[model samples]
Target: MTVDDIDQELLRLLSADGRRTFSEMAGEVGLSVAAVKRRVDRLREIGVITGFTVKVDHTKLGWGIEAFTELRYAGATPVSAIITSAFAVPEVQAVYAIAGDPDALVHLRVRDIRHLQQAIDRMRRTGPVVGTKTLMVLGSWNRDDPAPGPVSDER
Candidate 1:
């Protein structure tokens, strides 16, 4: 469970490109392919590396509208109930347990403004959600094509 420098390096490489061959990663990290594979498998086993998948641009997929909704619930609400309500709607992509005025923050994607409104309405109708404030997303970007945090000589 203790991740060493080599393990961090392997994680960084895989985060950049999950499909990168172990041999290719070996060249970058100065390890044998088998060694890299072992580290990666261990990373998975220990839950450091969970699962890999393709990233898609939601806008390009006709989901042109995105929104961040801050949900307010009555006093001392359980987070599991909040998550369950959000996940029941397919438009909800990510849920954040917030620390401020709002009980939770949710990132949602929809085909258009109408769809966004519908998703918000659905969340509001959920039993424990007292209220919600939604903010429209203008644009976004990702740097994960080459993920940060290199395993430098600091190890």
Candidate 2:
């Protein structure tokens, strides 16, 4: 439950690249390979490290547009219903139910502007959605990137 400095370092390395070997992590953390493995295993057993994921370039995979749509529900729409409506559209990558004028925000990846419009239309028609405003992403930077720019520095 308590992650120490070394465990945090290991997590940072793994987040940057899930494929990093335990041996490499050991060298970075100044521990033996077996020790590093044991620590990583414990991290998983205690649920600190639930799983690993791969970073993808959607543009390379034919999804050329990424957008975020703010959704406004009519009144008292259940969170489950909001999630269900967004998930029903395959282009939706994630949804956030937040505390604001807009009840939810949906992240989507689509082939083009027309596809984005269609996905947004579906979101409105599926649930108690009363309104939606979409903003196209021109560029993005993630801290999980192995070699990120100056904006990623938290130190």
Candidate 3:
């Protein structure tokens, strides 16, 4: 898709609140509920709108430890193998294959530091078992700051 101004506005509204009703969005975007629905459907069909999900407080869920681990593997060790190993451990939230000294970066959220260590040990044994470096997060401000304004003059 080729998104226009109205489509952008509709997206902005839905992003702020995914469960927002089509009727309410129609009122804000100056379109009928059915028209708005069509546009949203098209967005999903084209893969612009993937899925909706709830944001949770990890601390409240008893998951206190958060860390970033840089992993290096011996030459010829497939990245896919490393990713599969990490995925087997539930604490591994995301895995990024980078283009630097460390071949991959893994994001983890676990019950505690000991839990994190256990996960790391498992992954180390599963993959090429070359080396690893981990940095535990003291704190984070993932959504504390107000986002900046638009870059272009589109608005």
Task: Report residue 127 deviation for candidate 1 (angstroms).
Answer: 1.4
Each candidate's TM vs. the true structure?
0.85, 0.92, 0.82
* Root-mean-square deviation of candidate 2: 3.9
lDDT of 3 at 128: 82
Give the top-scoring candidate (TM-score). 2
Against the unseen true structure, what C-alpha lDDT does each candidate score? 0.87, 0.91, 0.85
RMSD of each: 6.8, 3.9, 6.3
Worst 10 residues of 2 by lDDT: 145-154
Model 1 ranges off by over 4 Å? 142-155
lDDT of 2 by residue, 1-155 (tens): 78899999999999988999999999999999999999999999999998998888888999989999999998898989999988999999999999888899999999999998888888889988888999999877777765655665357
Counting only residues 3 or more apart in sequence or on different chains, how many pairs clash (N, Cα, C under 3 Å) in candidate 2? 0
lDDT of 3 at 96: 89
Q: What is the lDDT of residue 55 in candidate 2?
A: 82
Cα displacement (angstroms), candidate 3, residue 85, comes to 1.5
